[model samples]
Target: MKFFSKRELIILTLLFVLSFVPVVGGAIRILEIAGGPSVAPDNPRISNDPFPALLHLLGAIPFCILGAFQFMPSLRRYAPKWHRLNGRIVAFSGIVAAISGLWMTNYYALSIEIQGDLLYVVRMVLGTAMVLFIVRGVAAIRGRKISQHHASMTRAYAIGQGAATQTLMGLIWIALLREEPTGLMRDIMMTSAWVINLTLAEWIIRKTNNLSVSGSVS
Candidate 1:
């Protein structure tokens, strides 16, 4: 049997494409930190304390890419062992990403112009939510509550993909306004990306659950 239906394959393709820009950006940042001289003038915060950023990038890259596959029902049904193993990796990477993100948000010496108060609070809340969602997903899987596990993991992955959505939002803001957003506008743009992703995630979860119920009933 095919691993994914045509529609599933298209969705997976879109997910990977969304991750491409962020993954490449993270790779370039990693290279800059590892190879360049100390005190990067362009991004002093990352140059000064690269550990958290590195951790977040490493975790987020895998979580975003590999976690996308977990949404494939055919793959999960056919390859249960792979699903379980990949799910573990996804959970661990998600937790690491969330913790590192929170750490950087709290401790990094970012100026208010780059990261306003609202953005700071939003990051903290979303990062904490991602970690909790991953933990709950694992607990639900352990309890054999497959639906809960799927929902929690789906929410966590949605939060994890915020970077991708942020990129899209940034492009839209630039195209529409003819200038990059800053300060409060930037915060709103970034927060709106997360909000959009979570809203879609919730909708997908509900739709999937409804479909499952209808399938069983029929």
Candidate 2:
């Protein structure tokens, strides 16, 4: 039996706390309690439409659940079917979320004087790309091109996962850094995470492909 080292244990503990913290739980509760976007406040840019709020609430639930399993291989073994079911759920939910987000982004009528307008455009672009990549990946899978499907879906998932991570980071920063309510910061973090995740996913694909080809040749 392998035991975690001190550093590993500490890291795992932090990850778990972040995954199941009251703060995260509270945020989720608020969204769940709100029921949908229509019930949310209409101030600032995001409230103009209910789709973004609904997308946000829908995506957040499964994202947090999956984040927990990310660190727990044992949990995966016990529930292989559950994991597959959740994956499909996340994929479908993500599409809805992305579409609504994109629509909201365009309809948000923030002025140029504020950074929120630029951030909305950035989010729209990234969200569109994320949705397109996932759709293409699913199509590839249906055509039986397993490797292409894997790479594309992996990239899509990475982008989605990264955005969630950025949201968590923003929550932390807001709680700790005494940052004022700059609406743009949330969008910036979310958009940047998508870019960062895609870059990392591409690099991973390249490296893995090279290694596979080398092994096959040998």
The prediction achieving the highest TM-score against the true structure is 1
State candidate 2's TM-score.
0.63
Evaluate model 1: give its lDDT. Answer: 0.89
Which candidate achieves the best lDDT against the true structure?
1
- Cα deviation of 7 in candidate 1 (Å)? 1.0
Among residues 3 or more apart in sequence or in different chains, the pairs in candidate 1 whose N, CA or C atoms overlap within 3 Å are none
Q: Which stretches of candidate 1 lie over 4 Å from their true place?
A: 36-41, 216-218
Model 2 spans with C-alpha error above 4 angstroms? 1-52, 63-84, 108-117, 168-177, 181-190, 214-218
* Candidate 1, residue 77: lDDT: 75
lDDT of 2 by residue, 69-96 (tens): 4333333356657655665676676676
lDDT of each: 0.89, 0.60
